[model samples]
Target: MRLWQRTMIRLARSRTITDFMHASRLMRPFSSRFVGGGDAGQAVATAQELAGEGIAASLFYLGEYVDSEKLVRENVDALLKAIPAMAAAGLPLHVSVDPTQIGSVLSWSLCRENAFRLARAVAEVARGGSHPARPALMLDMEDAGVNRETLQLYFTLRENDLPAAVTIQSYLHRSLDDLRDLAAEGAFVRLVKGAFAESPAIAHTVRSARNASFKAAVDVLFSQRARERGVYPALGTHDHRMIDYAGMVAQANGWRRQDWEIEMLYGVRPGYQRRLVQQGFRVRLYLPFGRSWWPYSIRRVGETPRNLAFVLRSMAGAAG
Candidate 1:
């Protein structure tokens, strides 16, 4: 890591800093941008508000890397609980799951099994299209380490004919080939310029490289056969330039406005998100909730260190 990046991570990891933000109501104004709350009710309610505003949502419970089967079961139960309320509200909601949150510490077989079980449940709900209220489930991508198992489980569902989506980060070098292969077979791709910290051997560190790689991957996703696999690309970013580029790609390819969606983190760039929605583009807000917000919020700040200054300013009542 560069000297500045390393320093930023250290600042983000400081217990004093994290604890204060977690304990203070002063931070709520900023936290409200990204995290719904630490509970299902708050998250669902927030999602409904967004739906009312013509924004779609992907509800993510904020927790990961659970070591016990019991905790894993609880996570599954949480998602199961979320389904009915989201359904009843007629909200545009998608269920996002991280397998590590369920059973990463368990045996590998058990971990895969837990993911499969979750996928099956989501499949069951989605296949209930007759109900007209079921939400789509997306298997979130973890660090490069979990990519293989993630793909295996995703393909298993494909074989079983379970309809689902997978997120792929652009930072990893191998994703170029991965995108081509997956796009060939058909998959819904959520393209994010990744947020995790990783060693240089596995991930590109320079913003330029990451941007180039991400754009290349986007090109692959928009290939001729994309729409056949329901490959409506979800551009998971807040950068205006990248959003403009996606618009050009859509126009060049003659893609319907519905064929692509812009996704933004709940608390970042609200004005930009609103403007895009007003322009008739589908917008999906990543609504993350739960007590696990601390770690997730830290990662977000670490991803863009300038955001740390913004958070501190928010704590000081300086920014909205």
Candidate 2:
């Protein structure tokens, strides 16, 4: 990782910095650009708006690394409420949850139970036919420390026939193998260029290598074997090169736009997302909400310092 990205990641982890940013009036506008609102209602509204514009959404209530069972249950209950609300709004939404937020830090057993509870709630909502299609319950991948546990929880969800999707980060050396394994199980997956700062020992530290790895991973997802196994791939990226590469692969394989989906963050590259949607591609917006927006926003900025320009522009507009 670049020095600034490493520094930003460290800053994102500091409680004092997070607290200060959250408390600052100036951070509100900046935060609004990324987070939908501080509650589920706003998230659902955002999904509704996107639906009107021919886009789907993935809603995430962002808080993580829960240490208490009470907190974990609260998160699951929040999702349980959000699922029905989205269904009521008639939005086909993907609900994302961090395994740690559910219970990874407490114990694997606890995480599995909480994850199953959330997954079951989502499945029940889908059965009612309130959504356009069966909504997906996606497991967001965190740092390397919890990667194994996260994958295990995802597998368990799939074993029980839950509509679960897992994220694979291209920066990780092991992701290609993991993608193949998941494909064999007919798992749905979202592929991302990783965000967390990791040691060179475990992850690709070179940008060129990471990009190459990302392309290679995409190739595996689009391959005939993956298709035969019924693996659904969602490409989560804003890079034009990667997006074009995905389009090329789809065309060459005679895959229709609906065969796979393109996923992008809510705030980043809005115009690009719209263009893809206009071209008849399936697009899903990753919309994160809740009071835990501070850490999440900081981490996003840490991943790409260019995002700081958005904050600056928001601040300037407020000042003017």
Candidate 3:
């Protein structure tokens, strides 16, 4: 990572600063840019609104690696509660949960239980035909340290015939192999440039290198036989060049629009997202909400230096 990105990542990781930003209204304008709301209600409402606009929604309850079983239960309950509204609104449910946030901080058994509990809930909602078109549970990949656990949970759920997906961070040296493994299991994969800061040994320290890794990962995602398992590779970057490249690569391979999906954050580049949808591409907007928005907002800024500067300026403007 560049020195500035490293600094931003450190700042974003600080709980003290995150708390301060959340407590003050001065950051609302900035936060509002990336976060749908500060609660579940607003998130669903936003998703409903997006549905009206012909865009798909993916709900992510804002939280991080959780240590307590009680907290994990609460998170699962909250997700279940969000489902009714999502279903009622006629929105296809795309449930995303962080295993670390659920039980990573606890023992391995606890983590497995927590993940299984989440899978059960997803299966329940999925049973009612509430979202027949495409209903899935996404296992949000965190730092590379938890790669083994994430892959294990994915395999465990897959073995049980659960409707599941796994996110792979291209920046990690091990992700290519992970992608190949998940492909054989017919798992939906979200290819992200990765958000966490890592050492050069395991991840690229430069933006260009990371982007290159992401492009290569996409090649792997689409190279699989779509006729057999149907690859649902979600490109999670806002870079127009990468987006254009995705279109070209898909076309060259004779893949249709539904073969892959474009995933973007809730509030980033709405116009561009719309244009993609307008062009007949499947676009899923990741609508994140809840009282845990602070950390998420910080991570958004930390992902790109330009986003951080824009947020800082917006916060200052809001204060003024």
The clash count for each model shown is: 2, 0, 5
- Cα lDDT, model 2, residue 226: 79
lDDT of 2 by residue, 1-320 (tens): 46777787777667799889888887789889988878999889888898999999988887787788888887888788888899899888479999888888888888888888888888888888856744789999999998888898888888899888999998998999999898887778999999887888888979898899999998888887777787888999999899899888767766677778999998998998999989898999899988877778877888888898988988788777
lDDT of 3 at 69: 78
Per-candidate local distance difference test = 0.75, 0.85, 0.78
Off by over 4 Å in 3: 130-132, 224-227
Query: For every model shown, what is its TM-score relative to the native structure?
Result: 0.88, 0.96, 0.93
Clashes of 3: 5
Answer with 2 or 3, whichever has the higher TM-score: 2
User: What is candidate 1's lDDT per residue for 62-97, written digit by digit as tens?
Assistant: 767777777778787787777666766766547788
C-alpha-based local distance difference test score of model 3: 0.78
Candidate 2 segments whose C-alpha is farther than 4 A from its true place: none
lDDT of 1 at 56: 84
Worst 10 residues of 2 by lDDT: 127-136
What local lDDT score does residue 51 receive in model 3, on the 0 to 100 scale?
75
Q: Each candidate's root-mean-square deviation in Å?
A: 3.0, 1.4, 1.9
